[model samples]
Target: MNISQPGLFGNQWCDAPWRLVQETITGIQSLKSDVDFMLWTGDTVPHVDSGHLSTDLNKELVRNITELMKSTFPTMPIYATFGNHDYHPKHVFPPYNNEIYNATYLIWKSWINDTSQDANFLKGGYYTVLTASGIRIVAMNSNMYYVKDTATVNLEDPADQFAWLDSVLTNASTNNEKVILTGHVPPGFTTPRAVRWMTEAFNKKFIEIVLRHSSVIVAMHFGHEHHDSYRLFYNQEGTAVVSLFLAPSVTPWRFQLADGEIEPPHNPGARLVKYDRQTGKQLDIQQYYADLNKANADKKLIWSLGYNATDLYGIQDITPKSMGNLLDKMTSATNKDFKAYVNWYNTNANTSDKFPCDDACFKKMTCGVRHLDEDSFSKCLTAVSGSVSLLTFSVYSVFYAMLFVAIYKLFN
Candidate 1:
């Protein structure tokens, strides 16, 4: 999940002669995996003011990022969705125009349409990619549903998008392919009240549609809320239609808490998700962070929340059986405790001089961050494995020490 708020930096930030392309290349190379496909969850350029609708510089930035991505991941298929920032011209401008939209789309098209590389880009910011495992990955154009006012935009209740989604879900169901939905804005969070209201409404409609084809709609991945979150939206029949997973932003800006505190603050990272086609299960979901503590750390590079190294903090196995159970628990006590832990960290954890939140408090508290019950169980499993490894090392150390002592005594 590559959801970086690049546009938040503004024109100056985007124009600044930065080696972000190189840093990005390094970050992707560190992952060390042949990914099936890469999802770019929008917001690629700096957010431009409404008046600067025709900013050529912003266009160049978008073009640069797209080109850079192509060079970095030559063989991987790249898909993109627009964020509010990317769709500013459509929303902020008085007249609903498609000039900026067309330009931005053209930029993506240039890279995606290029057949020279092993990349396949989709049109309309929404399209389906049939993976080798027979799973259908749907990337939605979330910008169509956003209605931005001077204050904020509504995200949750996207009626038009919901209609489009309904059609997509219906088609996926008929085809009998497992579905993974990717977009910019997620379906939860009530802040930015208008967006929340829309999202809630959208969720209701989305849940209804998902319930109709519950088994087909497996996971919904998104990035907007710059924190890792998972919520399962179920239908009245107790069928789990969608499991919402929000990816943290790979940018410096962290979510502002109620007390004006930010926890696990201002790090850049991305998620590596592996799905099992046979069982429609998420085999592995890990978050990776760019290391910022090195002697010559690039100040421009940021780490995502929960990012430790060039990857996520933990190795979570969400295989079919585990994922089903995990989703159930995640929406219950498990998720609540996770949120509580974050609140505590924001209020109590000190991140002033640190890179990512790597204090003991964070390590001890991470297990409780989300989906408490499942994470707790996961933590127990991790502890047991850790203990076994430690014990094995200790036994060897003791045996070596005893042998050395015996040899010394014999020599004496």
Candidate 2:
């Protein structure tokens, strides 16, 4: 559909039209001089149903986005991942090589610039690219963790990605190189619903892998939820080890899901992460976004800073420790920190119909952020929410006690 004036988020139903994509690219190009490389945690295709799409159509869509990135940043490298929607059948990635993989390898070979890692990318849509000194970028096909990817979901080690990830991380640790992990879907539930992206078993496995290699990994980035939120990876001791940043999508489509869940509209957001090239330590994330409503109305896009991570959250840096502290602040719904959390965490819609961020929402989000395993997430809600219920009962008891004293005084 050709929609020019797509308003930024309360009830917009249109996908990112071509003009919108062009304008978004223009906004990104504004940072060409300062930015180094790009992390395109993928979903090049639109949110169209599987029945209407074909393998060729999906391939073209990937190619189109790739070419746009190439044209925008001619010299800069873009490490991309395979999104579930990039597949024709959508979320049915196989353990074995396929037609699209080979095609993608050819289309992306220039950007990857390393034919040495060709085999793995062809086999299971993943590869590693070493940047400057002491840094490596592992573009994993996390779509394997996706629950609807039935071909590999039941398999204990889909695409052998976990094993490969372990080996890669082990190698990075030994080489004294820090790795930046990039993928499509992250290991947490969606920002709103405790939606199932990956199955419980896969999520658990993914979390284990992160914990095992937490020391060697410097930063992680993913995109899929299209919601501006992040996940905290904690070790068995409940200490945060790694942080995964989920960048909001360029597409502002409040997607029509099968289950009829509707997310409030959000402006198109792109994050520019500042980091130490030597240590691979992320310094900050500069989130840039255009007011979809204003831009569309004005017939031009003006991207501005939505917020900076360290500054807004009052955290020292974008690390697991700081992120864990942020999560802790978010525990209380009435707190100002959580108020800001709801604003930015909901993609800054501030729409009238925007859903309320109640204590229940906070509980689900907290558990989702802390526990990557679905089972652990459920258990966390049970333990925490159960206590909340008990606290409610205690408050009722105190109220009744006060009431009885007042009644006795009145009788006297």
Question: Which numbered prediction scores highest in TM-score against the true structure?
Answer: 2
Off by over 4 Å in 1: 1-17, 47-55, 90-97, 110-124, 147-160, 190-200, 237-241, 255-264, 278-280, 291-316, 319-412
- Per-model TM-score, in order, reads 0.63, 0.89
**Residue lDDT tens for model 2, 121-229:** 9899999988644469999999987888889867998778889999999999999998889888778788458786888888778888888999988778888887778
On the 0 to 100 scale, the lDDT of residue 297 in model 1 is 38
Error of 1 at 79 (Å): 1.2
Residue 347 lDDT in candidate 1: 21
Model 1 lDDT vs. the true structure?
0.45
Q: Name the lDDT of candidate 2.
A: 0.73
| Per-residue lDDT of candidate 1, residues 161-198 (tens digit) | 45556776788778777887777755543221112412
Give the Å shift of residue 218 in candidate 1. Answer: 2.1
